[model samples]
Target: RVKIYEAMEAVILGADELDMVINTGNACAGKWDAVRKEISDLVTATPDTVHKIIIETCYLRDEDIIKASIAAMEAGAEFIKTSSGFAPAGAVVGDVGMIKQATKGKIGLKAAGGIKTLSNVLSFVEAGATRIGTSSGTSIMKEVR
Candidate 1:
């Protein structure tokens, strides 16, 4: 279950943004309402902070990804992220594009996980990712320079 009070505690502790992972189990079980409700509650709990919901696309089918993206947008998430970077794979261009279509530009898109190069970053951006999360920032910056 989503912990609304704990999320509020983070806000009270001075966190300005939150990146939350949706329950992939519920999503895989085809519980769209549960998925949406959890995200909505989190958003409602911390209205002052930016909410970025990680759908963990690597574990989902294309249809699930699309559905999840739409649900997050409707639930008031500011961004729908591709992964938490702990999956078997990270963000992919195709997934990002699919998520973009599902959200219809109403919400932001973030590409995370395994993004290690400037080329990777550029590809995701071209695919409609508005934000990028990576651990290779230093190397990626070197590529830019």
Candidate 2:
């Protein structure tokens, strides 16, 4: 319901990708249905656009991360993203690894937030992250030595 409007609004504004936060609260509480529904809503709203569902791994347990990632993929998301950068923690190599393994070369994986180093970004890539998100773009780029 919420993501329906927001995703449509993003599409209207010409967003090439629709990245929406999963119902992290409900997801952590073990309510997989609500989380998957939210992702599904956005996917339906943006059929032709890329739908990235951010699982916000910082607040989730390892099991929850796997569940949420799988749910997002089952609900038709094109990408499973880790974190919104608003939480206390951000994307980790382990989390990315779990997500990558779950995706099984089916959907894309995006690692975002707290990714400040070249090695960190590269590690996520090696873990099969197709996209890297960070606020420290310049410093990360400077590591090209």
Candidate 3:
């Protein structure tokens, strides 16, 4: 039920956090005003919840990524995340580094997708990612041991 809930609707239903993808095409085309408005609308609705804006870093240029990160933050995102995990490639160290630098620690960064190893986790952390989103948690724990 949670996964199927539309972003703001989920927050209304008591979700503590909301991570939803916007129309990435708009964001990628430098259409920040509309994208910002959309994201802000959700943020306004979820004032009590942690709203994460997924920018799909794999699909944008560094400048575009930075712009998306700032727009999301300015619009009230608690975090700016890198992928929906449906892209051919997921979070990369360079993308994380750029986002970290762009946000300047004002908002948290979540590095998700294709993160299968401890080193991959550390790389993102070192780049200022505050959260790691991965399906390989158990394997990462095993690698730590």
Best by TM-score: 1
The number of the candidate with the highest lDDT is 1
Arranged by lDDT with the best first, the candidates are 1, 2, 3
Give a tens-digit lDDT track for model 2, residues 49-127: 9888888898888899889989999999889889888888888998898888877858899899899999998999998
Residue lDDT tens for model 3, 1-145: 2333476566667789888776689987789898888888887766778888889988888888999999999999899989989988899998898888888899999999899999999999999899999999999999988
Off by over 4 Å in 3: 1-5
lDDT minimum window of 10 residues, candidate 3:
1-10
Per-residue error for 134 in candidate 2, Å, reads 1.4
lDDT digits (tens) for residues 23-115 of candidate 1: 999999999999999999998889878999999999999999999999999999999999998899999999999899877789999999999
TM-score of each: 0.96, 0.93, 0.92
Rate residue 104 of model 3 by lDDT: 89
Of candidates 3 and 1, the better by TM-score: 1
- Candidate 2: residue pairs that collide: none
Model 3 whole-model lDDT (C-alpha atoms): 0.86
> How does residue 66 of candidate 2 score in lDDT?
87
